[model samples]
Each structure stands twice: as C-alpha cells, then as structure tokens.
Target: MAALTASQAPGVGLGGHDGKGADAAGDASPGDGSYDMELPPLESPNPPGGSAPGGVGDKSGIPKSVLAAYKKAAKSLATSTPGCGLRWELLAGIGKVESGHARGGAVDKEGTTLRPILGPVLNGAGFANIKDTDGGRWDGDTTYDRAVGPMQFIPSTWARWGADGNGDGRKDPNNVHDAALAAGKYLCADGRDLSAKADLDRAILSYNNSSEYLRTVLAWFEFYRKGTHAVPDSDIPPVSVPGLGEPGGGPVKGTPERGGKDGGKDDSATKPGKGSGGSRGNGDKEDGKDGGKGGGHDKPSPEPTAPHALERATDQNITAVAGETFAARPGVRAETAKGKSVKGVKVRFEIRGSTQATFEGGAKEATVTTGADGVATAPALAAGAKTGTFTIRATAVGKNLGTVDFKATVTAPQADKVTRTETTALVADKNGTFADIAVKATRKGKPLAGTTLTATLADTAKGPFFSVDQQGKQVRTPVTVETGPDGVARLSGLRADDKPGTYTLTLTAEGGAKVEVQLTIKG
Candidate 1:
C-alpha cells in the first residue's frame, strides 16, 4: 500500500533532532508538541510520476499520498465548517515543517506513515511536560508523552481532536489523513477563519506557539499556494538546501541563488528542517546538474512551463432533483499549449447562482489541485431543498486560460398532500358553471406550485361536469389544471346536465394526494 517500495524508503523518523529541541517562548503546550520535531529531509530526484497523489509546484515534491491527505482534510472541513476556509496549502505548510511530509512522503498509499513519528519526551526538560495520556498507546512511553504522528499531535491533544478521516474506523495519529484532519479541526476550532491573517497566525501559533515555527510554516504555506506539481515519492536524492550550508564546505548543490522566485524559495528568515523538519532541495535546476555524485552526472535542463488551458472533462450541463445529489460531478483538465497534460495547476470548482446546493460537507466552493493526469474533479454536489438553475464554474488559478461552466438545473419536488383552500362548499352556477374553488398542493407546509391537479366528479351521469376549455364547448367529467404561484389550482366551470343533486368532486395532485370537495346543486 505504500507509494514507493519499502526497501528504497528510508526511516527518517518524525521531525525531531534527538528530541532535544525546546520551545524558546516557554508558553503553555502549543497543541501536540513537547519539543520541536526535526523536519523531514527532501531527497526526491526528478523521477517519473506515479498514479497516487502527487504534485509539487514545478517539481517532484511532497509524497503523493501525503499531499492527498492534506487536501482531503481541507475538503472535509469545507463541508463540516465552511466558515473555516481551511486551505490545503496551510496544512501542507505545517506538514513541511512538522515531519518533512512524513520524511518526504515515505507513506503508504492510504496516507499512513511507514514509521511512528515520535518527538522528545515532554518531561519539562526544555519542552512542555505532558505526561502520558494514552498509556503509551501512541508514543510508546508510559512515563511521559512525546509528540507522535506526522502532524505531531501529543496523546492528550490527539484524544480530543482525533478524527476518522480515512473512514477506516480508527483514529491514528500515525496516519497522515487522520493527523491532517485532527490538525485541521484544531486550527478551525472556535469558528476562526484561517483566511484572515490574524486568525491564521493564531492558529499556527497554537500548533507550535513559536515565532520561528510560525515563520517556517508560513513560508511553506505561501510557497504551496503559489503552485505545485506531482513528483515521484521515491528515495530522496542528495541535494543542498539554502541556509543549511554544505557539510563538506563544498559549493551549495542548488544551482539557483537563494531568495529567488523559482527554486530558492523566499523562506529565508528561519532555516527549515533544523530540529524537527528537514530542508527540501532548493534550486531551479532539474535533477542533478551541479556535479554531485560524479562527473558527467549532469542531466539536461528542465523543460520550460508551457501555457496551459482548461478543458471540460465532465458533462457541460448537469441536472439534479431537489434534495438529491447531482447526477454527475464536474471535472476539468489542465493541458499545456501543446495539448500535453500539465500537473500542479490549481483548479477551483465553485457553485454559484440562485441555489442552496452544496458540495460534500455543505461547501459551495472547493479548490482541488491537479494530479498527475492533469485532472481535477470536484466533490459530489448535493441539491438542497431550494430548486433552480445554478452554475458550477471551474477556473485554473494563475493561468490565463478561460473557465468552463457547467449548467446545473434542479427541478421542483413532488407534492405530498393536496388540500382544498376553501373547505366550505362549492355552489353550482345556474349559467352552466360552478363557483370557482381552489385546491392547493403542498409538501410539509411548503407550497408546491406548478403542480397539475385533476378534478373528477364521482357520479358523472348525474353530477356536474368540468369545462375543459374557455368556450365551455369541450366538457368532461375529469379536467386537469395546473397550480398557480400559490400552489392552488383553480377549479371552475362545473356544468350539470339539467339535473340537481349533491355530488362529490375528487381532486388529485402529485405525490398520491387526493382530496374530496362537496358540490351542492338545486333544480
């Protein structure tokens, strides 16, 4: 179930530098950390892509499974708490600084880390003293509790914020999906919107409560938001990261200068992967070009990113019934100018117009990153009680490519009961017609307008007949009339065959609704 083979994957452990890192601020337990965990090392070379979750901004970064977990967590919150506005990039930033994405995506296909990521023991020794809460269940320590899992949730904190993200019926901090969700819920608690700068900072600080940690995570977060591409979750390669000078005092492996837009990411203030997180490769050059392993080890330069265009992958026009799921989900593809699939483009699927329809988790808008296939499909959409036409627009972020719009139509619901507006009596007119009476169709008190109702006289031989037309020339025992905006269908033009007697008129509408109105005639 692992994204990469086990033999090739190394055991980097969780982010921690021998569990000796300390929180300089000396504040309360941030969230799930006793001591700062060492960042995972970035070692993936320019390898071929895989089918599982994969993508980085123009490079092979973040294991496919690990990336998927972050996105899934954010998507889950979008529905459970739309006000949170949790973005996958935010979670990714933290993950980058936490365990270097499970030591650079050394995770199984199900987003479970191959190893149990544990931090230093929290015995009040240069770290928060959090005693064992899980009885050594998570951290394998009975005396003290150390941060565990890819997101580094302490046992006590995990107990409260733990979530079943993968639907595996288990809440495991070692699983990236579970940890990402637990982390996301914690960040979104108290109705805080991460989109706001203040709230965003607060949430990050609550996780580690360190200004340096916050800055490191924010750097990664901002970089991810810019864009990413799917890289193979293979063994990490030997490359130099900016600020973490070469071990042999050799020139930095990265060909590009630091603090630039391309590879030398602008996360310059705090050196990443110091204690708990490890540094990813920082360079614009592809694979190996700085002559690392041996001479002639240089490879060709990376291809220039071509312009991309958005194409509709799913039905252009979709439909649904009120209070039902949409038949088909809207999907889009990002293709290069030469029609080749492009990876790492951010595609935003938005629900707009006059409808209360929401994607899974009650979210109207969701952003999905393009996977290896350059495809992004939105979450399942559900039409709420309100019915009308709406639009699902898919647009590629940072791309000049135009958007694709999916026209969604939600039809009216069936009526449950048909009742008479005036239950008193229907008086027959001497002028070959009956006084106008109305029957309404409703579903749980909500008016169901535009419903068709048929009126039929019980005894057609002697009772009044209905005028099917305005001229009264076309008459019949049963006539059909559609309800108006008030959900009431007007019944009129009841003519008798020169006979006077009390009769019953049966009105039937949608949803097996049948009502009887008494009609009295005197001759």
Candidate 2:
C-alpha cells in the first residue's frame, strides 16, 4: 500500500471526517473482492476549464493526464455502477496517496502511464513476503512479485479486479485509466455507500489497512475537493511504501524509489500484511477458506540491520597545469564493516572548489557505482582555466557509509625560449651614415613573431653612433623596434658622428638575450 502522509498540508481530515469510528464497517480490505454495488452516473470535479475546486490547475503539480484519468474513471464507475458516490477527487486522492501520480513520471494524452511502475519485493523486512505468483511476468521477480501501477496494486489483486477504463480491451495495470477505474470499482464493491464518513473510511481502508494511510489519502482527497493549492508540506514525513522509503522501505534499495521496470506480487493485497488490519489473509476469506476468520499464519517481520559501510576516498591529491586533464587518483571504495569490498555501491562525485575543474567524461554531479573490487573510479578531472587549488568530493549514497575529498592544483603555463640573429651587419657610407640593419628572432629554429628588439650604442653620447630623422638630422642613439610576421626587425639611418672608428652595437631581445655587432664607419 502507498505510505503517503499529508502533514505538509494543514487541516487534516476528509470533508470533516477524521477516520475515527470510520472503520466501523470493518477493517479495510485489499482491493480483490467482487462488489455487487450499483454503479452511479459518472461526474467530473473539473469544470469546462479542466480546473477542479479550489482553483487547482496543472500548477497544483498534479499532471493533467493523471487528473483527466481520475475524472474519466470516476465518471465511468458512476455510469457503470450508479449510487456509489464515487467522486473524481476521491479517485485522485487514491492516486496521490499511492504513487505521486506515478512519481512525476510520464503519463500520455490517452491517460496511459507510459512508464512502468513497480514496488519493492515483499521480503518480510518492513514488508510481507509472498512467493512469486506470475512467474516474474508482472513484477519481474520470479521469486517474489511486487505491486505494480500508479495505484500500487499487487499483480494477483490486479488479476482479480483489473478493468479496461479506456476501452482498450486489454486491462493493463500500468495504464492510469485502467488503474483508476479498477480502484473505483474496488472502493464501491459490496454496495458500500461512500457518502457516509464510516463507509468512506471503510472503502479507503479496504485499499490499504493503515490508519495513517487513510488519513493521508483523505487529506489529499480533501485538498482536491476544496480546490486548494497542491504544495506538499515538507514537515510531514512521507509514508513508507514498497520501494518508496528508506532502503528496504520499498521493494528497491533507495529513497523514494519512484518506479522501475520490475514486476512482483503485492503482499498487502494477497496476504494480511502491515496495513490489512489482520483481517483476511491472502484473499482466502472471500473464497470461503476460514469462514471470514483469518486462518493463515504470518511470520514475524525481521528487524532492520545496520547500513552498509563505506570508506573514505583514496588518492585525494592531484596536480596538473591549468586546463589540463588528468586521472582522478585515489579512487573511492565501498566496503562492509569487516573491511571487505562491497561492489555495486553508488558513489556520488561532487565539485567543491572551482566549477572549472570538472569531472571529465561525465556530469559535474555524477554518480558512479563501485566495481567488483569495491573501488569506484572517477573519470578524468579537467582543471579550471585559472591556477588554483580545488576539491572534488566522493560521497556514498545516503551518506550511511562515508565520504572522501580530493584536492587538485593547477599551475600557469611555462614560457618558450627564443634567440636573436642579425641577417645583415651594420656598415657606414662615405658620409658616415649607416644603412638599415635587419635582425631576425627565432624560437628553436622557427620564426618567433611579435618579438620586440631594442638597439643601444656602447656610448650613447659619444663618437660611435647616433640616430637620424626623416630629414637626415642626427636624433638619438638608442631605438626600440618590433619584429614582424617573418621575425625581422629593422634599425635604419644610424649615423656615426664625424669621429669615425669601430663601435659596438648591442641588440637586446625581450627575454634578456643580447647580441653584440661591430660597426665600421668612414669619416
């Protein structure tokens, strides 16, 4: 049965009925018996605008397809089985309490829940264990069948009460319309009048035996009936359904296991399980087994064991250049308290320091499972653009195990080596004015474009050198020039002062590399 709670929504109770003395009719039955109740005319809570009371629309977070199916099923039940007081809100309430309208999964326009929903295996730990009934055809567990569909019906129960709400001829539990109609029919069976508080409680309890389940369904029912907004209150603890609570709360191992492809028989529907009020066992009473007295003996449920153990992530230190990719060393491991390796444990990797340093080959917040060796390996880690240290954290699912942090250091890029060459030496003409001297810069024999070259005379103010303007007048001795694409820089119009002699010309590149050339001038 679905373990929904409405503590989040204030004002609990269904239309003022508090469920006290509501079970006077009898303990709720798992939806399996055939009802002889008269079918009432079908009606819809939603008006022409497809909005229910309290102005709740799709914004209520209830899917439109699911809401429409509820209305359709309610109308179908009322038309086919009159005088049952089957309201669309009541059907919707059941859907919400059972599976969150298929846990925000896919529901098509034809009122079909395209995604298959399965509950956990009833393995006697926080649940009743029933052997497989359908050869793993329905719940996928040949050993034990689970409840299936948005309404959370066990396969055996579905076989007994399944109906084709969409007129599809096939009665599929995964179809919302079919499941909704089947639920409505189950609620109105035995000619139970739902207009009365006692009858309503009896009908809901019949679906699931928990008093808290009744309150939750009714709370959602009232929420829909009044047309209030559908914000679920966080304060209210969610009820545990097969595969919908803590690991072992449901058939699967995870929190709020919405739905999966597994199939199984529902123990609550077949046997007198947790919420069945200890009444009928395995649908035998109606079949004339023990004459209405539950004759099947139930074994005591097993106690919950401690959670699986997880060790801190190993190889937490990594170093790399900015924007470089490297393996995330120190893989994480999952193990038992005895220090033995445990495989298939889910480990979540989270980025803590910089968004730039990401888990390469996967999502930033990716979850990877441990391999056979109990070690979970992370994809390559790419450092961010800037140089700094960041942290990546690997934590076990549910944190029941533990977590480890990996630190990464990124450094700046290194500079390249360069050399300077003078393609042409400096020489003075008869007037003692020198021609342009061409110099080239290269890094490892390849032209190093964009290098800056500066020329300085051995003596700035003395006889050897001087610079000239466009008009041929002496200017200065030191000059700065930038190299072009071919790595060539030109120093033009160097003039020797009237005193001619051999002079030293120093050419310096940006990185402190210098070349000295002898210049000869004629007076």
Query: How many residue pairs clash in each candidate at the backbone level?
Result: 29, 35
Q: Kindly provide the TM-score of model 2 when superposed on the true structure, using C-alpha atoms.
A: 0.37
Best by TM-score: 1
Model 2 residue runs over 4 Å out of place are: 1-61, 228-523
Candidate 1 residue-wise lDDT, 1-523, digit = tens: 1110010012221222222222232222323332223222244334335534233323336667788899999999999999999999898888766665665565556666544455555665445555656545455555666666678777777767789899864576777898999889888876678899978877777676556666667766776666665545533322222111122111222323322243332211121122111111122232444434431211212332443357777779998778878879999887642245678888899998989899989998999988888889999999998978989999876554557899999977778898877767776644467778788898778888888888787885665776545764546557788988888888765666566778788888865688888887767
lDDT of 2 at 438: 73
Worst 10 residues of 1 by lDDT: 1-10
Put down candidate 2 lDDT per residue, 1-523, tens digits, no spaces: 2322211112222212343432232322332211111111133223325443222333234556677778888888788888888998888777765666654434544554433355545544444455655544445455655666678676666667778888744566767888888888888876877998878987887676556666766766776775623322122112222223212123332223224343332333333233211111121122213234322222222221222344554665878766567644547777532235777778887877654777756457678888888888777777767788877777777543435777778764321333335445666754567777777776556565667777888866555555566896665557787778887777776767766677788778776666677887765
Best by lDDT: 1
Model 1 residue runs over 4 Å out of place are: 1-60, 234-523
* Full-model lDDT for every candidate: 0.63, 0.57
